[model samples]
Every structure is written in C-alpha cells, then in structure tokens.
Target: MATIGIVDTTFARFDMGSVALDEINKNASARTVRITVPGIKDLPVASKKLLEEQGCDIVIALGMPGSAEKDKMCANQASQGLIQAQLMTNKHIIEVFVHEDEAANEKELAQLMENRAREHAVNVVKLLYKPKKLIKEAGTGQRQGFEDVGPLGM
Candidate 1:
C-alpha cells in the first residue's frame, strides 16, 4: 500500500488541493494510497514525518490563493518548505496549485489546477515505478503487476 501526505495551504476555502486529492483517492488504483491531511503550520516537518512513519511513497502539497496578493508568495513559501522536506527525507513531492480566487475565471482555473495535479501524480508514479519497462516486462518477473487494480483495470 502506498501512502500520501496531503498539505493544504488554503484550509478555509475549497482549494484545488483537496479536490485533486479527492480525484486521486476516488480511483480504484488509489485505494491503498492512504492520505493524511495536516494543518498548514509545521507542514513540511509533519509531512516528512508522515512519509517516514507511514512509509508514504509520495507527498502531495496543495497551494491556494491567499487573502493578500495573488497568493504567489504563499505558494512559493509553501513550495520551498515542501522542497526542503523532500530534500531531507528524499520523498517524492507533488506540488499542486489550487485556485480559489474569485477575481479569476474560477472554472478555468479549477480545471487547470486539476489537470496539473493529475499530471503530477502520473509523473510521480512513473518516476517511482519506472512504468515504461514495467509495462513491457510485466508478468516476466522484471516487474510486479498491479497490487491494487485501478478503476477500469488500468
């Protein structure tokens, strides 16, 4: 089973981070991917600890627009913190930008955020498992078959 640590910078509004997590968790293949949602403070440390303790294979960091500015600063700070955690723990990190600003096109922003998160997850899985050879070598002892079949038996 794979575990994932979820860090949401925007705890108040319906941020893209949680939505992306929901999408990931909804997949049957993600059934064993346990997710933990921790508070913003000490997020880097907490996420690293969760990865170590829970044996999480990946860490997902979610960012949202802040009350001030375009929330870019907050995102940058959060991303930096997550990067530090990744460097220290050597854990795979997926930084997702969630849009919650009403000034922008909310629907378009949401779609873009969701797409980015999905792509990040795919990339993380590929990097961790080396899927290209695995796909070709599956059932040949070179690669382990899917432990938990994804939806549609991906």
Candidate 2:
C-alpha cells in the first residue's frame, strides 16, 4: 500500500490534517503518517523528514498563514523551502495553504480548512492511483476551499 505523509501546523486554528486523513481513508487504502509542527515555517523540514526518513511516497504540507503581512512573508519563505525539499527528494509534496483572511468569520474559516484539506486528500489518491483523473481536470479552475471558478471563455 502507498504511504501518505501529512505535515500540519499547530498555529492553525483548525485541525485540517484530520479532515484530510478522514477523506484519504474513505477514498483509498493507504497508510498515513502525520506530524504536527509549531508553525508554517516548520512545515518544510518536517515534510522533508517524512519523505526522506519515513518513506512516504507523497506528502501533504498544510499550513494556515495569518492575516498579517509578516505572516504572509513567512508563508512565502516556507513555500520556497517546500519546493526545494521536493526537488531534493524528487517526490511530490502537495501544498495546502489557507490564508486566515480568506474567510470572513471563524465558522467560515473552519469550513474552508476542512474543505481544502479534504479536496487535496482526494487529489493525493488520484496522484497515487489515477493520475489521468487530474489530466481530465486540467484548466477547469478547480478550487478546493470554495466553489470552482470554472473555465473562463476562451
């Protein structure tokens, strides 16, 4: 069976990793390895370890960037690190980042976190077993936390 790695941040207001795990369990028969770090900046190293040491085939790096400018800058730096890790490991690290400002209220924020995580979990299943499913979705504007914008008129 495939092993899926999940790296989440404690700084997040919601436990999106659990939501992803549930969705992954429902969609595929795979073993999941999860690690909880302190903040978004910690995600890259934790995720790299999951792939390099824990032998995960794919990893989901989940983080919630706060609504401050510094937080956004930190998120960008963390994202660069994640990309570097992926290149060094030659493995897929699916990024699932939700900005806290994306939602208007706490309730909406929680919902976005759950929705995004669950959607990306399904993507993981596809990447592992049915990659062509994603090919069919290309350019469809498939948003995770909210309604898809759909394809624009060409």
lDDT (0 to 1) per candidate: 0.57, 0.95
C-alpha lDDT of residue 41 in model 1:
40
Off by over 4 Å in 1: 9-12, 15-42, 99-103, 131-154
Task: Tell me the lDDT of candidate 2.
Answer: 0.95
- State the displacement of the C-alpha of residue 123, model 2, in Å, after optimal TM-score superposition: 0.8
Candidate 1: the clashing residue pairs are: 29-150
Q: Write the per-residue lDDT of candidate 1 for residues 1-154, one digit (tens) a residue.
A: 5565555543534454555566566542542233435434445665687678767777766555454664556656666887888898887776665535533675655565666566555545554556594476455432111233333432
Number of clashing residue pairs in every model? Answer: 1, 0
Q: Write the per-residue lDDT of candidate 2 for residues 44-134, one digit (tens) a residue.
A: 9999999999999999999999999999999999999999999999999999999999999999999999999999999999999999999
RMSD per prediction, one decimal?
9.4, 0.7
Q: On a 0 to 100 scale, what is the lDDT of residue 113 in model 2?
A: 95
